[model samples]
Target: MTDEPRLSAQDMIERLGPVLSRRTRIRAVTALLAGVAGAVFVGTLWWSEPGPLPGRTHLAFALFTMFCLTWAGYGGWLVTRRVALFATDRVIAAWIGLAASLATTAVIIVVAVQRGTSVGLALVVGGLFVAVALVLAVRAHARRAALLRRMHELSGREER
Candidate 1:
């Protein structure tokens, strides 16, 4: 008797469904999200009030938020089209890291400006954010490299 185990129909469907879904519609979904984020960013810029301490902070936060949303959406769109499921984990991790860094930096800058924080203190805070971001980005890059190596090994085996 053959040693290969047979997969049931449900098992096959479960295995293949995600591959098919990723190949078919991931790019479209990312694009739609990008468009929506861009629209919201614009809307916030056009409509948010601008006349107080909190308003100033809000505006600064909004700018950073816009950058985060646009970058994530656009990057997701690009990565999905090219990498499919290969490097998505790396990309998402990097995006989260960057968003955290930028948001932290922006908030610090806003608060510093609003409350007249000393330059030394602001610099220290900024440094902390940078350190955290660097760590996260490096981890993500390592993870991606590992994944790429695995894919390369699998492909080489298939050729043999």
Candidate 2:
């Protein structure tokens, strides 16, 4: 007889509640921090010039926050699922995050262009987000690789 205990769907969900809540709280706090930092950065840049274009910058920051939150939520979901996140999942998540960032960047760029703001600024913001995404994705990939390697080594030793 197996020692594993059977659990129903509701039981599983109930058991996962605390874990999910913890994940959600962490994500929310991190998102809040990012939002504040983004707002400050964009606000400083947008208001640096003597004009009425701060509104466009605010809009850009809003979109950027939305994208970041969405990406973070995806990442948090992956973590909460307890899946053996492989390098492939990391790469895929990075791609999805990049896609979300690019989409938001495009929208902001369009807004900035319509408001007669400098396009270079929007490009800079987009590039910054891409860079961050790349770093995170690479780190996640490395972690996954290390974990797999350790598992392989342990399993091989058990056969001796």
Best by lDDT: 2
lDDT of 2 by residue, 1-160 (tens): 8998665434444465453456545654565566456656655665575756556566765666556565556555555554333355556666767777777778768887898989898999988997887787788778788867866665566556
Off by over 4 Å in 1: 1-46, 50-62, 71-83, 92-96, 99-116
lDDT of 1 by residue, 1-160 (tens): 8998765434443475454355336654565576567657766765675665466656765665666566556655654553235555546656665775776676777677768776577668777877877787788777778876876775566556
Q: What is the alpha-carbon RMSD of candidate 1 to the true structure? A: 7.5
The TM-score leader among the candidates is 1
For all predicted structures, in order, the TM-scores are 0.52, 0.48
TM-score of 1: 0.52
lDDT (C-alpha) at residue 133 in model 1: 76
Candidate 1 at 114: error in angstroms?
9.1
lDDT score for residue 142 of model 2: 83
